[model samples]
Target: MTARPPLWRDLRVIRAAAQVAALVAVGLLLYVLWFNLTNNLRRLGITTGFDFLDLPSGVNVADNPISPGAPLRRTLLVGIKNTFALVVVGIPLLTVIGVLVGVARLSTNWLVAKAAAIYVETLRNIPPLLVIFFVFFAVILQLPPPRTPLVFGGLVVSNLRITVPWVETGPGADLYGWALVGGLLVAGGVAWWRTRVYERTGRPHHRVLWAISILGVVAVAGWFLLDGPIRPSLPVVDGQRVSGGFSGLGAYYAMLSALVLYTASHVAEIVRGSILAVPKGQTEAALALALSPFQRLRHVILPQAMRIAIPPIISQYLNYTKNTSLGIAVGYAEITLIVFQAIGNGRPAPQSILLLMGAYLVFSLTISALVNYLNRRLRYVTN
Candidate 1:
């Protein structure tokens, strides 16, 4: 009797068959999606090419310089830029706050831990939209209307704007930009030197000190060398609306703060769970070595817990990014809001929605890819 084919050979055949089946299924699904899109587009007498992108978009965005006469493609690009601004700003702020709250939940003090738990439980259970609304009403709306601005030092804060004295652009702005770039490079080099010192001497590398000092030195030198070309654009207490200085609108800050807080609560829970999941022996060993609690946590517990925490943290980031779309209710003008407004104004809903989805998909996937790369680097490989 002929011996049965080797299991490895059979397995290959089985895998090949499964792959073919999957491909067919995927092809069928894509065909259905394409057919539906084309059929509906045709039924509605809509042209299906991306040519609509070239036509002038007849809508205006708040705070953006984009005029209604701008091409639809340009409007979409502005929407994308707005979405990116939120993601870039929100992710770092939320991550820092989340990690702090997560660690706080594990605090030895009963009150601290309980308070953290309450915060997480309360915020995580509520809808993000409500949180946005609450933030708008409670914090932003309470700000003095633009007429009577609250002045602190030189900064002016009010409902219509939050203006801080900023480096005013003038001639030699190009020189200032170059100086800033040089300062950053110097700071990076100093940080690298500090790392080398730490590696050789096992001393606490004050990379932060080195970087800050280099940056400060360069900045001061640049200021004088340029004859004070960069003057402060102080906000004046003009009637109602303040002029000059960079100001973040009340709605923008409200949306950003609410989403950050709402998402941080979920991140806190993930961190707490990950910390608990760490092997108890690891903590005990650190204690046996007489490591201080904070040092033990920073060096041992957190490093390990982070490996577990990162994946979930990426999810929270993605959620926060997507939730920025809900900023429409608060007039944030993120991609989703802009797209919805466009659709409401009689643009092709399906294509606009598709573009919106694509924007989010890119954001989510890019974040996931970065996290996954870091996760791989941090993960312990076992045979």
Candidate 2:
């Protein structure tokens, strides 16, 4: 180190000095912003602390269990649950639709390819809000009203709500549920055991087959032993009232359908591009190896394409999660809707807005982390 340069002249020391200065500047800026915000809010006669969260939230979310007098904190959590319901259901449905459409886009049949292209182009160009509006007003609202609802067996449809047959737990339900959990644990243990046996003895291990067989045996035996712990709850409508089974609100379906279709359009394009990005030589090699087309696509194309596709798809997921706020239009009470409702009900606007931002940040970060973990697992590693 050339006999220790002057502290200020040393590169490491200079970097450290600059970092400290930058950190100090950032800290001061944050302090100033917070001070200004608090002062402004104080002047406006708003409580700046979070004690308001413990106060009664005199608001009720439609189709949700949150009562008007519930604590604000509990109300917000219930809103989060409603939002997460959409995420869980919509994401899987959209993914399946996207993958099918993407694969169809690459089909050799003219009709199939053209149809997929038209779907992708038409939906992708239109704004997502328009899609949501169309689904809500034109599709969902256009359904026959509650009194003259359409029905097919256990399925009941109307502009007000859609009801479907769902499982109702009976006396042995809790025990049956625990039994299933135990089966899952046994399956997992068996799989690990099989893996270790394969590693030690270098033998073929049909671990998945064994695990599924074990689980299936447990499920069937438990069902009979527990004397049918679950039964179907079929819904029926009487005039404007609907009861029995699980009733889904028209607004929920409208928002879920619109968001899934819109996001799937973008996902379709991502998937198509990723699949096309796979080397043509890989396909040719697959053909040379005498693999069937389905096998070739399944085993060779998808794995590679998925690795390329996931990074961009991560952003799409984050976008979709944020876009769930649009459910407000259809009156599906998600977190954003609830937060706004709180603000309208004399809640502090600034703090409520901050909480809304934090809610979205948590959702987005969680999705990003999960997808990034998958991407990492799928990536190729080398020495």
Q: Which candidate is the best by TM-score?
A: 2
- Candidate 1 runs further than 4 Å off: 1-15, 194-208, 380-383
lDDT of 1 at 82: 81
TM-score: model 1 vs. ground truth: 0.89
Query: Which parts of model 2 have CA positions greater than 4 angstroms off?
Result: 1-9, 189-209
Write down the lDDT that model 2 would get.
0.91
**Model 1, residue pairs in steric clash:** none
Best by lDDT: 2
